[model samples]
Target: MSRHLRLALVQAPAESFEQFADGLRLRMKSPNRAELVVYPELHLCSRGAEAMTLEEYYDTYAEPLDGPRGAALGALARELGVWLIPGTVLERAEDGKVHNTAVVYGPDGELVAHYRKIFTWRPYEPLCVGREFVVFDLPGTARIGLSVCYDAWYPEVTRHLAWMGAELVVNLVQTSTSGRAQEIPVNTANAIVNQIWVASVNGASPTAQGRSLLVDPEGHVQVAAVGTEDTTLLAVVDLDRVAAARKHGTGGDSWPWDHFAPDDTPLELPLYGGRIDPVTWRPAVSPWTPEALRPAVPAPVPTAPCPAAGAAGEETAR
Candidate 1:
């Protein structure tokens, strides 16, 4: 398979859906000549105290997997002749909750994948969170593993995606003013460990600390924005490069636990009856163990503070 590809990262300050769409449409006017265009997370909503309530935000900005925003994005991808990876948005779900969703469109304006941020940001606790990891196949290119902000902090998730055969990973982040710095390394490490390319974008200026970065399989920043200014960054990635790294003696050359070890070894645990059921979100126990050994109760969902900032007022500006 061919590895050569180009990517564009949109780093702009946004206050509303129209503003975000305007920036993206302008960027589409003269695309970066890349195979993919990535935008920052939550680029559709205003940031800060004025950020809209979950309901208000969804009512105004949320799109179905095939809504206008989705169609427009798909059109941009087809018009530019490149894959489009817009940052995450608040997608209205039937459960009356908003999902931190990311949508990917193929070059032909086809829906490739739609993923919700599994590890939702703590501050945005009131917002609904996704419960599963999702990956989708690219028609002519390699499969893509998708995740949203905060998911990068946990490598196990990325590792799982990699194990599932995702050659490329897209992380859509809307990092607050204070969290960008710490998030970079976590994301970088994730790319390195998975031996896959990671394209990440963030909000810039008054909206966010836009430091969109495109990382190579070696965990090096191939392209990035140096300042907190609103701008776009571009890079060319050769998929062959990532494949070669994996073929070589790289960190995540393959699954970490390739061969089964002795039962006492850490990697052997899974082989020796320590595996989690992939279908059911539960641990798989040994057949010899009696049912009495099971835990009496399921783990509790931890409660956190949600400022309830938006539900009570009009979307506040930062």
Candidate 2:
């Protein structure tokens, strides 16, 4: 099977729900239409939240997974015959807790997967954190994983996803322009170290610079949006690069999977255990069981031989 996937990244301001839908419609109509369309984090609620209080934003924008916004996104995916990741929505789950949720719709417009933001950006954002990492199969294509905004800062998030057999990892971001220089490099490094494709989409607001980008397994930036402009970046990602990268290490050394232990038994470090006062340093109980730590199935091995050095290059469609 061909391991190529054409993807479209939508980088635009979420001024209103209507504007978001319109922008998405326009992008989908492009001559370089893609099999997958991705949007920025908090794409539907961020702009509106700027004008209202936190409580008001929650009351106004937070809805269930089956609400109007999710329905509209599903309809759009069905209409375009594209797999869609419509960014992270502010969801009020049945548990009555509000979460920053990312939803995936299959080409047939069915909800296939959803992931809540595990590491919420702190200080002001009020959202319930997610416990588990999500990686799902994309039928005949490749397994994909999702992270949102600050989650990319934690290497464990991407590493766990890769360990779980994700060839491509998507990150939806909503952050200030000042942080772009820092954010891009870190995410690019995540791609290189994890040996997976990293597609990051950022919201286009005055506060947020829309430098959406795609980084290949080799850590090369395939495509990036210009400045804070509203634009769509389209690229053809070769999933085969992932296996090649894992087999051949970055910097001329063989990739060192033999020494790495992802499932090492838990051990308490003395510095953490002995330094901090037990009363003040209470750790939250983890929700993941031993079964959850293991991959549902082993990652599919690539049958093809590695490409010649420097043969893998960015395939961008403006």
Candidate 3:
């Protein structure tokens, strides 16, 4: 039995929330209906260039997950009757720190999962790092993992998700004009190495190269946009293919995880777990605190005193 998921990658540039909504409606209304639709990273703030200062930009664009914009997106998802990964946005959490957050809405208009980008393309872009890699079941489809932009660069991000039973990885990207050259290959490699499907969507602006892509488990480019143009690319992802690919191995002698010895390995990295306060959205205990499972460092061996020097001299002489 072939389990197929029809997905659409939206590559349109929006200058305002209205424009974004319109673009989404246009894609949704397409004759070919998609079961899932993905948008680019920072789609809500694509007009930030018009702001005078960084603070001004964030202030004008950043919104809470349940804010008016988020509500509108949820409503749209319900209206279209499609699972929507509406790309990333500047999420102003209750902690007062802004995060590059990707949100997923199910067809019933509920926020299913929220993933913060662990790797903030730093020095180049100033953004707070996210602490969690979120994965969720897609009901009738495969398990899904969420990443944004630079997160795809780290092989561990996808591997961790795959290890946790994710069959498809969606990366929402906002790359600089010169970045597409690098972004495409890295994401392609991620899909191949992890033996999972990858759907990457980038903003269709001059600043962003716009080349959204969908790579199969075998690292084949199933759908890709040509240039910076307002367009949507559609493709059918087969979970059956993912299973078949994993069975064949990742084009290597052994699975990547097989290379590591499991003995004495910590069950979980303390850095990766936290308890967030539901109301405040802040961590009850910081993830940065050292974990108890960390292996203790062995003390340095005691050295012989003057005898060592004498012994060395005797050895040399002999």
Candidate 4:
């Protein structure tokens, strides 16, 4: 199935949820026969949480997965006969917990897949992070993985998704000036590792410069937007390229396999012994290091209760 699908990426100013949606609707008047339309992270809410208080923002802007914002996007997708990846939204789940969620709408105005942000930004730890990585099969030989803003920084997450047979990884990023450089490496590394396409949608303002891009499976920048102005990016991607890249060794002369392997033992060292600051006696550098660079190992997985407790009551009853 060697067919091409057109994907549109919107890079607009960080406006209020309602205004942003209205602007998008106006801009997307008649898409150029595109198969999908993608948006940037927190497309509804501004980043930094500077404009509004948490309580006020949540009450005023938060939507359920099937709420008005979602419904409208879904309807748009159906109207256009396309897939719509409406970045991540601050939404209230049935559990009453707030999550940063990405919802996919199919051409029929039905909810295709709903994925929440797995890696919550440091400032918003109070919000519950999503535990699962979602990859869904599309109608016409397309497989996609969805990610939120900060999630792109974690290469392991993208690597695993690539391993799970994702042909494309879509990221909705809220790129601040400080962390903009990191985005390229993160997305490109995934393409290099998994040999899949990456589509990134970024915000356009100086505070949030849009560096929207589409990278090939071989980590080549197929198309990228300028950071100067607000714009929408449109591109046609061939799924066959992803499959070919996976087989052709990413067109690289060399690959660093030694880097991805698990270490034999945890690296730890004493803090101090003979240091320059003798009175304080604190080591300038400690040998202690994490199993991986992204984060320390998570706590051990919990085990289920043993079956003996269930049988113990049966014997007494008999």
Candidate 5:
């Protein structure tokens, strides 16, 4: 079987949830429909809230996963009979903190998976950081990973997702700044390094700089949405390509994932002050496991003073 999934990336313009929902209903009325549809970050949030304080706006919409808005989104997906990723919504956690979280709804209106933004564009973004990496199965088609706007900028996030066996990493973005120019390259870079498919979807004009792109496992941009215009990019991605890329080597050259042998010397990482045993390494631990939930960054380890050195070390210490 061709494990190809047809997708529609909705690069809609600045609009409220109601407007987007209505448009989605109309779009699904057509015969040509994508099996899965994705929107940009914060697509359903009230753009009118832009006038309000960020805190006010986030608090106003923040709700749990089973909130009315979430149920409505799930119903929309079921009614349309398509897998839907309606960008992200502000999730009100049990601890009363608000998080920018991405959600997926299946064709059955079932909530598939939710991943809170890990790297929340810190120093500017007030949302709390999420600790775990999330990947979900698309049943027979593929296993997918979720990340928000700023998460793609960190290679560790995507690398971990790939380690968790994600064939496609969906990076939903909403950048209204010039920094988007750099995101494009990083999107491709992530795909190249991981040998996985990447769909970096950004919003359209007035709200974002829409230079969304879909990259193949070999880092080739298959469909790049031009300009900051409201548009829909349709493509059929074969999950098999990801397997083929990893198996045959990326562009038939490097095979990073399988390069190390069991008997090979463990490569030492000075920053971590240890080497990962190639035979015993397990990078993708289940996020839900209590023992697996280590601090996002490990605590600093105390080390003994360096051995007495020559003039160079003396100068460094001074």
Candidate 6:
């Protein structure tokens, strides 16, 4: 059984919700429809709202995960018989603050997963931040991870997703600034380091600078650069390649995952005030486990510098 997945990344710019729905309908009507269709960030927030205050705009359109927009988006996916990610929505959380949330609707039109933007664009984006990382299994296919625009800037987010067994990470972007240039390399670098496919879909034209890309696990550009036009980047990602890359190595040579040796002491990350044990650092069922990873055995830790060369009996004392 070939673990190949056909996906479409829609780099459409900010448009009215109705326009987006119509375009998606046309997409399904076409013979080239993909199994999964992903749109850019804030693709349906309605661009005209820029005239309003941020608070008023969000309050006006923001909704819960199961709000009307969610229902409509889910129905569209089910009607089209395709997995859909309609990009990030303004989520009116229970805490009275709105959050930029990315959602996934399965072919059945049921909400599969949703992640709030943990690294919201900061001072510019005045919304509540999400506190969790999310990864979802795509049934018989590979595990897929989700991230918003600015989240890709933080490698920790994607790293955590890969650690959780994600073979692909999709970052829905809506960057209209020159910063998009810097993000190009960042996307590829993330793929190279994590050894996972990355689909960074950005909005196009008047709303954003476009330039979406689909990078493979080996950091190979599958669907390279596309201009600031309404584009649908398509590709067939092979999960087998992901397994092979980790088992063998990226480019069949570099295996950074082998950096740790079994029986090695936990490494301290002063940055996060955390330590990771070599043997159990990765999540359960990970390739980094002791038996599966089969890393090189390390030297035993010397106990307190040999007790200052004390007597033989004393040396063995606790």
Model 6: per-residue lDDT, tens digit, 1-318? Answer: 447889898888788879999998997777548998999898888487678898678767799988888899989889989999999899988877788999999999999999999999979888899999998877777688999999999999998888887889999999999999999999999998888889999998988999999999899899954689888877888866766676688988987665665657789999999987777544222332234433344444444444455676675895
List where candidate 3 sits over 4 angstroms from the true fold. Answer: 250-318
Kindly list the per-residue Cα lDDT of model 5 for residues 35-97, writing each as its tens digit. Answer: 889999888775876687987887678899898999999999999899999999889999988
Q: TM-score for all predictions?
A: 0.75, 0.80, 0.78, 0.74, 0.86, 0.88
Whole-model Cα lDDT of every candidate shown, in order: 0.68, 0.78, 0.76, 0.71, 0.83, 0.83
Give stretches of model 1 more than 4 Å off.
Answer: 15-22, 29-31, 47-51, 251-318
Candidate 2 residue 83 Cα shift, in angstroms, is 0.7
* Per-residue accuracy of model 1 over 112-131 as CA lDDT, tens digit each: 87887878778755667787
Per-candidate clashes come to 5, 0, 0, 0, 0, 0
Model 4: per-residue Cα lDDT at residue 81: 70
The residue pairs in collision within model 2 are none
* TM-score, cand. 5 vs. native: 0.86
- Model 4 TM-score is 0.74
Clashing pairs in 6: none
Q: Local error of candidate 1 at 217, Å?
A: 1.3
Per-residue lDDT tens digits of candidate 3, residues 172-223?
Answer: 9888658788889999998887778898898886647788899987788999
**What tens digits encode model 2's per-residue C-alpha lDDT throughout 94-191?**
98899999999988878899999999988667799999999877776678899998999998799878868788899999887487878899899999
**lDDT-better candidate, 4 vs 6:** 6
Which one is best on TM-score?
Answer: 6
Pairs in clash, predicted candidate 3:
none
